[model samples]
Target chain A: MPPPLITARSLVKRFGDLVAVDGIDVDVQPGEAFGFLGPNGAGKTSTMRMIGCVSPVSSGRLEIFGLDPAHEGRAIRSRIGVVPQLDQLDQELTVMENLVIYARYFDIPRAVAQSRAVELLDFVQLADRADDKVDPLSGGQKRRVSIARSLISEPELLLLDEPTTGLDPQARHLLWDRLHQLKERGATLVLTTHYMDEAEQLCDRLVVMDGGRIVAEGSPRALITEYATREVLEMRFGRGRNEERVDDVLGVGERVEVLPDRLLVYVADGESALAELHARSVIPESALVRRSSLEDVFLRLTGRTLVD
Target chain B: MITTRILPSALLDVRSPQRLLERNAMVYRRSWMVIFSGFFEPLFYLLSIRIGLSALVGDIEVGGKLIPYDEFVAPGLMAAAAMNGAVLESTMNVFHKWRQAKLYDSILATPMSAGDIAIGEIGFAVIRGLMYSTAFIFTMLALGMVKSAWIVMSVVACALIGFAFASIGMAWTTYMRSWADFEYVPAVTLPLFLFSATFYPLSSYGSWSWVVQLSPLYHGVVLVRASNLGEWSPSLVVHAGVLVGLSVVGMAVTASRIKTLLLK
Candidate 1:
């Protein structure tokens, strides 16, 4: 529907000899919450920048809202909002001034900019701190200001590069709530994050990227089902003793993933896997049974945890 | 060859540079002290010349004409003042915003291009320079230093000088990789201010007068001094052309540098 809001084919971005974004294809439909999930230096930010029309594509074809980024960046950028990884809030201006001036960049008249700014600050829960400079605000409040500033343009699409990288749990939940409201209001969101929980909570469909390439792409549940078992049994042994019973723990489930401090057994039923482990006479210091998640899918696909 | 098209259309873009200028003005409004701080340096140099330096040399001769030492030194300081105002904005302020604060990164996230940022910044610095030049020339008038009606042209000359320096200063700043790189700002501008025929006539440089002409500030000093004393010659056009050419080159360099650095 709507012919996909964005489409990229063999998209490549290179900085001299270093290829940050290798050839990758992507499609994002309108009204969809799509994610680029990966660890650091996965070229997720590069892809977001190219889509935001701020960074030109080094090679390959990219179209946003049916316009080529290389020649029609201003046109494409006008209808999209971008929240950069770092809080780029204007330290010199008050929080309110930051939003108002950002509106002016999209050519919104002053009165309209002011009205929208007031409403947006209220939405981001920063209405009380409107007059204060950004330097004195908490990291969360500064981030909220950045979000409000991005929304001032009333953009059709929003690009968030690590929307919640360095926030406390409560602040992240608050941001998540605001983003949920935006989704309910029919805003198309494209975000990049290393947090599997953030991706699970926000993105409807996502691609797992590693070393500048997409390893997997699907809905959270679909990816876990395809790449992981229904439940995972994690048993931790003495720090350096996990390797001693590694062979005995094999074949207890569909497969096993060994972490530095623990062993993860993928199984349809965790209690049965525990019974089998007990039958093997290998007692663990601690054992946990939890449902499989995107983290599991990431581990299955990339052989590395999402956050690392 | 990255061609920076500083086109009329870009200037006319409704959303552009004016918004950038407005942001700068808003920042300055809250901290009037920063503006006044840059304001006082040129005046101190002028007044010190009036009270101290002028006492040592009563009058100086230039271009087959003799003028008060204060008159000769006033325009040089005025030009330097304008240059200082523009350079401060384009260099250190830009350095902070680009390096420390990362403000330009935020602006680039919007529809505003690097060219818009550069032009907006240079425009504001030129405006700041004009304000300083206006105040300085009027102060010269009050001190009875105005010798001719041509003094009105000094403001235009200062604006040109400021634009040239602002553009070049911004280009130079993009190459600064660390805080220590900024030491070159004062090291270069300080000596250039003193040696650009500001306190002494270019002929004082003797055989080195040709080298003096090569300095961008030398052309600015010549233009300001000639305008202040009502001295007219075809060389005024040459000086103005030099500034204009430098402005263009600087703008191009700054545009390309910002594109490579940020948009990478």
Candidate 2:
């Protein structure tokens, strides 16, 4: 088999006395949609910056396309596209001018750059705003323009940090569709997000990160199954009684997590678990039976929610 | 094992800075009023200082040569104009892009390195400085400020002066934390403008002439004046050397400083 498109062994990044990425290891094969799932300040952006060659790795072995990033940053960066956490578009220039000027950094010929800019603008559905300055564009349009700018170099690997953090649902769906098309064309993707649904929808394989460490690594389904039961029964009997009644359904499932607002019974069959709860005369204000998700797995590993 | 080689690419890639210059050109194309408005500052100074102040103070001597008050200060104004344009472009414009716009973050993602940004920004500053100098020089020629063919070479001098200060300005700006720190720019350059043997001869200061000798603007004024007067001296080499040396040292420091700050 050919080597993985990216490889990192004991990669470390430090900012002064703080260790942002503390000796983690990861590998990504070509054409795979890989993800880093973490909450804020979980070292996801730090890791992405090292991979992007914009931030220096304090110590570690990192190779992109078999080229050492520390030594050949320019060469490595030429093959990779980075959509930073923020939209860093030039507010003073027109949307098309942003892409064209970015292409100039790679020494793309003017005519070729213009044609590619036109095509990319069409791809992002911003062809009509090509002549307009970026400051007046809507948030979604600005993000699409940023994505278009990233693709101007036709990079082999695309790195997106929180690509859909603040987008409306419609905008996010459109971005997902555009990214899905890119993946279908065999472009390798690496992304980081706190959105579990986004990870489940996009990543083929991923690692769950917390506090500068990888707590779990697997496919979404594998992680959900391994870290949690096949289903979860959510029972809320008002705040005070929810905790008191937890012991009544103790043996109905493999494990139970008592949250402040509800009780979660982990079981292979949530329907049967709910029946058992009713037979025991434990009536709640509301009850829900649903399949397990990555959110459950994250809660199991970190003992906290992803967003808060 | 991994070893890093700093700036593995060629030192001072001309193409990158050229592209940066092109980007600025496109941006300014839409805002031609800003460029047109820059022309009036030096002319205003020439008319106000030369016509108004000269009528009261009379002709002055510089470098042991007596010349008309307007003639004496025209080249000095050109040099000051070059310094102003270069400093403003490099410091304020570059700082705004780096801090507020975060434009460099996007540019750095490409194959361009920190050095490319430094060179590119300086190149843009030099282009603007030359434009302002050209306008000032043409006005000087119209007002009978040109005494010889050597005035043609003063444009080159203006460019050099711009290059020197632009490099230094870019380097200095990296050390600035915010817009509040920019007050030092006018504080420093204004004094260089008013007291650098620009308005009068070194003899005006008498024993304190040593102060003018220490100012970079003094060398700039002498060089531009000599060219305008069709005089050449070996001392011109010293003046030109200072600007060139400043540019080289400033560029070197700026490239590495940007790398340290951004690539960390």
Candidate 3:
């Protein structure tokens, strides 16, 4: 792989007495989709903001493109794009003007900016709403417009903070498809998300963070393999009886996690584990056999779900 | 090779102050009526004070000659007009965009610097003020208020006031935290409008005459009045210098504040 595009050593961000991002180290290689996977308030956005060069690093070193962000922020930012947690598109301007005017900030010539804006709007699939004000667009359309605006500069590295946090599943899938195409075309993506499915779907490598520190870091499959069983048997026992049956489920699987409404039996083969439970006359109200995923990995690593 | 790599982008950065204008212009274009609406407040004041209040107040003496109440008040109103436009754009409009609209959050992610935002915002404010000043000036001229060539200096003074007030207004905006904090705008500007010798000569204030000169609008009013009264003095340079100096300081403070706020 080529040299990393971003490097942070003991990275820290503080707001008054609150330490938003504690000392942590990370490196993002070029042309790869890297993600910060954590629950909300886990310092993912703070780290993203620091990489985007909008927030000042309180201590330690952060270098993007091998230049210190403190002194070279404008130059570093010129080549990178940022999509904040919220859709901050210019509300008064039309969808097209939002992208075109943003291009002018990078000093793109007017004619070139205009042409690129047309294509970007088409890329985000908003060509029909080019002249419409952004205020009236749906949440998904507004997000697409914001995405198009960030791409107007054709940045080398795109930083998206919670790109689909508030979107519905259909909107999230649509955005994921668009992002997948960009990644296939070799765009470097650095995104933060609380959704394990989003992280697993987009990230080549990710770090699981909890409360301002990274708990684990690896590829999704590797993280799951290293931290979780191959499959999980989810059994619900007539609500309020899940915890009472925990002693009976002790030797059934590799391990068991007792949740409020269900019992997650982590084992190598969930199907055989469920059959074994039935053979032993250990029945449940309902049972589901599935592969262990990044959510399970996150729960194992942080002892809490990725999203509340 | 080295020069070719750096020159074009550097030139663009230097020219980015107007990028702020292009952004705001697109927003204001569809809402052009709202922008045009700012022109009429001072115009109405001009008409009402000229037609109504002049009859009640009669004449006032300045520079050893008696002048009509309307003549004395016109220059002050023009200065106040410039102040109003500059304040509204730099204060209320900027606050809305920064806090409610979150416009600069996106702009800060670009290559533009805080100085660019400061220049762009103050430039827009100054441009808005200039249009108002021009409209009000023509009204004064049509009323037979120009006997001396000094009236041209009023335009220049209005431009200076625009620059000074816009810069100062932007600097003040960075200190604001919430919409409630904006009440201080009229709390401060209203008093300046009334007591900055805007409607009356400073001589009428008696013992408080010296305190009135402390007002930034007082310098603007005095400068524009000098041009209207056709009484150009070497002391006019001091008034002009105060405004120019304030513009420089206010712009520097505003740029730094914007950097701290948006880029932090």
Candidate 4:
């Protein structure tokens, strides 16, 4: 078997009295795409920082490509690419200069850095704006340049934190495609995101975290299968109606959850669950049936609510 | 055993700190206007305050050598300008990149360490300060204000002064929470600029001259003025020693403060 590209054994991180990551163990095998899916303050970024060797672990062990992060941080860092949550491109530099200078930071030769920068700019679809200053680029263009800059060193492992957080749908899809291409080339990817579709679409394996602890771990498909039914029936009652009284609405599902804004019925077939609600003489103001996804897995693990 | 190899690789990246400094010069090549802006401010001060006001103040006695008011004030403006340029870059520009743009956070993710960043930035400031001082020296020479060839030493003195201010500015910038915190920099700097004998001689202040001697800018101006007047004394050694001491202390503080800010 190929070696695990990354391994963490009881890793922990603390900031003063607040424990950001609490004894989390993670393993990512070679060529696999791994994700940390959680809401804000869920310790996902903290975990990634430790793996990137930028933040020191408070306790326990972490090995990137079988090298210790503590003693071999620079070596580990040299072989890894990181896209931070916020774009950090130099505003004073042109887009191409941003890439070339970043390559220079890793000691890449000037000619090689220049050629690779051009390739990466083309890859990110920002070749035409190469000479434009970074400050004038739109949000998505800046993000693309940032991702391109991260790849300047041809890293073995790529780490992205909220890679598509603020991007529009079209821009997000473009970024996702670029990331897919990177994975196809056999690089290990580790990412953190709150977007369920992002996790389901990209991650081969993932861990769900909340309050600094891992609550679930599996493939996106396996996670949904274990935590939720194949389909979900959503019903939104009028604002004046009490959603907590969801049991009166239907009886066709194995389980039901009453959220402040809606009611979710977990079932093998969502269409049958909707029909059962109609038979009970209960009318939802709005209703929809959808396949179970990472969203359901997240709601089940962290309770039915969105967290900032 | 293997870890030792990892340790050296961290420091062995081909982009030495020197390369980073050279990159700043390349950036400056394209943005020469920004650097030229620093040079003109002092030249404007020399023209407005010394030339314009000198018509009333007449000649001034500096270091026991009678000289035109413009000639006496020119070297002090050069030193003050160098200090200003370095401080502006290290403080305002550095703070903007650190807090607003998130630039250093990205650079630190690469093979560069906080120490490299501190040195790289100061090196850029020194080079820039050198440019402004050199240009101002040429302007003085053209105006027939240079009393001796020793004015070349003033350029080096100003660069050293720039390093001291840049280091201190960088160290203080870590504590700046907002743009408003910068108000105190000029509020304090302007007082030193006015009272540090930049426009007049230290002895002209009579018994209170000792207070003027205590300011760092005063020491810098004294050294530059002494160099320009060709009156090198044992006190010149004391002035150089003070500027050197400031640079060391400032650099030590900045290095430690930046490490804390970046690593934390």
Q: Score every model by TM-score.
A: 0.95, 0.95, 0.94, 0.90
Off by over 4 Å in 3: A305-308, B1-15
Native contacts retained, all candidates in order: 0.75, 0.89, 0.93, 0.53
How displaced is residue B52 in candidate 2, in Å? 3.4
**Candidate 3 C-alpha lDDT tens digits along A1-308:** 78789999999999999998999899999999999999989999989888988888999999999999888888999999888899998888888888889999999999999999999988988899999989999999898888888888999999998899889999999999999999998999999998999999999999999989999999999999998899999999977899888877778788788788999999998988889888988999999999899988888887752212
Model 2, C-alpha of A116: deviation from truth (Å):
1.0
Clashing pairs in 3: none
In model 2 chain A, which range of ten residues has the least summed lDDT?
A299-308
Local lDDT at B36 for model 1: 49
Instruction: List residue ranges in candidate 2 displaced over 4 A.
Output: A305-308, B1-15, B62-65
Model 2 TM-score on a 0 to 1 scale = 0.95
Q: What is candidate 3's lDDT per residue for B96-185, written digit by digit as tens?
A: 988889988888889887778888999899988877888888988898776577788888998889999999999999899998998999
The DockQ scores of all candidates, in the order shown, are 0.76, 0.82, 0.77, 0.50
Q: Candidate 3's C-alpha lDDT?
A: 0.88
Question: Which segments of candidate 1 are over 4 A away from where they belong?
Answer: A304-308, B1-15
